[model samples]
Target: MRAEAQAYADKINAALALLRRFIDWDKALRRLDELNARVEDPTLWDKPREAQE
Candidate 1:
């Protein structure tokens, strides 16, 4: 019984870790989208360094 409980706990912990990674990935995608939108602006070249980023 104790082993079963430990197994369940391990699975839950693994799932939580995966969820955190997914959230970070989603945030990164959103940031990329924002940067891409900025690149579409004609004046983006005004700050070439920022645009290149």
Candidate 2:
């Protein structure tokens, strides 16, 4: 039972490591902040292409 629990824990840790590599939290947060700032801008709607992104 202990061995099985350890194996599951190892698998979960490995999956978490893979996800950390796949997702850049810092960059994503920066982009979200930029988008939030853009949302407050009056000119955001002026550029249809930029607003749609």
Candidate 3:
């Protein structure tokens, strides 16, 4: 029972961290867009091969 409760607490902590990261998705997206536009003519490393995978 103790182990199960600990696991649940850990899971809740992880979820809270993720929720904080995405709480302001709109602001984050806007910042990303601003950075994208300021990039050079060729553009930032267009191929995010690692991200794609």
Candidate 4:
């Protein structure tokens, strides 16, 4: 590939990587929200999962 074309591709990749950072942050926040919703419900511990004791 030509140098100019390669340079453009590199720039696009860098921008995409930066954009994915925001996407990752959005997903993390969503997961935290779901976790917080379940955690604050207070009935999640009543299901009786495997006990470590």
TM per prediction: 0.44, 0.51, 0.43, 0.46
Candidate 4 worst ten-residue window by lDDT: 44-53
Per-residue lDDT for 1-53 in model 1, tens only?
A: 99999999999999988888768877878999998899789999998897777
Highest-scoring model, lDDT: 2
> Using lDDT as the measure, what is the rank order of every candidate, best first?
2, 1, 4, 3
Better of 2 and 4 by TM-score: 2
**Candidate 2: worst 10 consecutive residues by lDDT?**
19-28
Cα-based lDDT for every prediction: 0.89, 0.93, 0.75, 0.78
Worst ten in a row by lDDT for model 3: 44-53
- Residue by residue across 1-53, what tens digits does model 2's lDDT show? 99999999999999988987999968988999999999999999898997999
Q: Candidate 4 — what's its lDDT?
A: 0.78
Identify the runs in model 4 with alpha carbons over 4 angstroms from their true place: 1-23, 50-53
- Per-candidate total of colliding backbone pairs: 0, 0, 0, 0
Candidate 4 similarity to native, TM-score: 0.46
Could you tell which candidate, 2 or 3, scores higher by lDDT? 2
Off-target runs (Cα >4 Å) in candidate 1 are 1-23, 49-53
